[model samples]
Target chain A: AQSVAQPEDQVNVAEGNPLTVKCTYSVSGNPYLFWYVQYPNRGLQFLLKYITGDNLVKGSYGFEAEFNKSQTSFHLKKPSALVSDSALYFCAVRAYDSNYQLIWGAGTKLIIKP
Target chain B: NAGVTQTPKFRILKIGQSMTLQCTQDMNHNYMYWYRQDPGMGLKLIYYSVGAGITDKGEVPNGYNVSRSTTEDFPLRLELAAPSQTSVYFCASSDRGSNQPQHFGDGTRLSIL
Candidate 1:
């Protein structure tokens, strides 16, 4: 079964500083990894996805993620954080050969302190 | 164009009551899904439909039922509501395949008392 683990429950970063949210995955076949962000009282918004290509995948809102096969990790990154960036982030993984029913992490709360 | 729409933004039900949460998509997506989000937890899939006539159970399908009678609508039914079923439900849709990104509705918050 494909599964995603987010080690951190919450991450705090100062505004204008770089931020990183860690994610790891376990799957049998090639992995399709994705990142999503959800604001309070709103549905999740897709950030980025890594199917197969460059290791560094850029996504919406100046966010990017690095897919490291050896480490089995895909961590989200941003050069500069903003107050509005504070939200709940989820990491998801799906097996390439399957129907893409995603398995998601518990979620990581990111707080940008000004 | 309203990407995905969900009705009954908020609802409160008594125990043993029944209710349906309505969902519709204008994108003409062939794949639709229902998920519930509990406090401090990630979303759990309740049901999914590959097409109009095909529906399947997901990870957390108990106490919940769903039907997709058309390409645009997928409604979730809850029979004999319980406090354990109270949570925020979200409806999402994607294209025919698994590679497409899922578009999500605002979500419906349901509480059982």
Candidate 2:
């Protein structure tokens, strides 16, 4: 079974500071990891994804994620955070060989404070 | 273009009542999915269809049923409304190939009382 775990319930970062949302996963074969953001009363928007090759993947809104096979983690990172970046972040995974079903993590609330 | 569309942005149903949540997509995606998001919780997959006429159960399919009769439409049926089933339902669609991110609808807020 493919699953993702977001250890932190919330992450607070100062405006213009670097932000990080942690995620780890367990799956069979290679994993396809994804990051999505949900603003208040809005549907989820795709941030980025890591399939194969390049450990670092850049996505929308200047967000990026690094895939660490050894740690089974794909942590979302942003070099500079803004108040508008405050939203719910979700980490999801899909097994390369299994049926196409995205397994989602509990999600982490990101609060960018001034 | 409208990526995905869900009807009845808000709905209230009494216990034991049944309703179908409608979903449609315009991207001609071969994969469509149904998910429910609870407050402060991650979205749980209710069901998915690879293509028209082929549907499968997801992690949380109990109390729910889905049918994909066409490439652009997939409707989810709740046989008996329950408080536990009250949540925001999202409809999404994606291409058949891997790594193709799914596009989501605004979502339907269903309330069971």
Q: Is the docking of candidate 1 incorrect, acceptable, medium or high quality?
A: medium
How do the residues B1-113 of candidate 2 rate in per-residue lDDT, one tens digit apiece?
Answer: 98999998999999999999999999999999999999767999999999999999998999999998899999999998999999999999999877889899999999999
Proportion of the native interface contacts kept in model 1 = 0.51
Overall local distance difference test of candidate 2: 0.94
lDDT of each: 0.93, 0.94
Best by lDDT: 2
C-alpha lDDT of residue B55 in model 1: 95
CAPRI quality level assigned to candidate 2 from its DockQ score: medium
- Best of the candidates, DockQ: 2
In candidate 2, clashing pairs total 0
Error of 2 at B14 (Å): 0.6
Chain A fold similarity by TM-score, each prediction? 0.97, 0.97
Model 1, range B1-113, lDDT digits (tens) per residue? 99999999999999999999999999999999999998768889999999999999999999999998999999999989999998999999989777677888999999999
Stretches of candidate 1 exceeding 4 Å from the true structure: none
